[model samples]
Target: MAGRGEMPMRPARPGPPMQYRGPPPMARARVEPIDREKTCPLLLRVFTKVGGHHQNEEFAVRGKEPKDEVQIYTWKDATLRELTDLVKEVALAARKRNARLSFAFVYPDKHGRFVVKEVGSTFSYGHGRGDDAKSLAELGFQIGDYLSVAIY
Candidate 1:
């Protein structure tokens, strides 16, 4: 202790030097491209009637009626015509079966409302000679997109 008018001194405590750990270490996740090949083929659902009854091939029907088989198609960047032909090939009864399939490519309009457009004539769905053809990719179609197939 010091007397009046005198100053008392205290020992300084030492601490570890401060360390700067700039922006917590950053980590990156590895990303890989999708391998379209060697995976389960892409399948599109088509609706058709059997025996005068409206049926959905993807969904099984009740009450003893034969279940319309679901058609499977390979994934490809194809035109509407090619998709239609593929459906025809898978659906053997499309030509003779009681169900008449009116193929339509459906997509949401700018308003987000689904619009089903008919694709029958060569001019339909932007398919024609030369560069008029439109591929699914150009149409902005992505995986899991649904194409409505109307049957009468």
Candidate 2:
């Protein structure tokens, strides 16, 4: 028996040296450097609240996790009317059949308080009322804003 305190004797000859069968494994993918000058488009987190007939079904499937209920979307070069349309489209796609959908754009004021504004169903051809005429960039919204959707 070999003891831990002493080295054990072995055969004087060593087995054949192991040889690699193929070329060296491929190198790992290189990480691309980020461009600091480039900035991301204004993005908003949306939380959908299910209601009416499909409310039970949606809740059953999605549970109550906020991450499962939230969606992130980018709105760039979009007017208020266009943004409303996009939000409506998303709501329609996500809601149950025959469900009515509404949008609320949630933003913060200069005092760091949140303000929610309801989006109208109809869209005007030209520039809209108030901040509707301005592009997203003109609205002074940075990335990571939020918009909540209500399904009825």
The number of the candidate with the highest lDDT is 2
Q: Model 2 scores what on Cα lDDT?
A: 0.49
lDDT of 2 by residue, 57-150 (tens): 2222223424424454555445555654555555554334444445555555576656555553223222344345444444444465555556
Backbone clash total for model 2 is 0
The number of the candidate with the highest TM-score is 2
Residues forming the 10-long window of minimal summed lDDT in candidate 1 = 121-130
Model 1: lDDT of residue 68:
52
lDDT of 1: 0.48
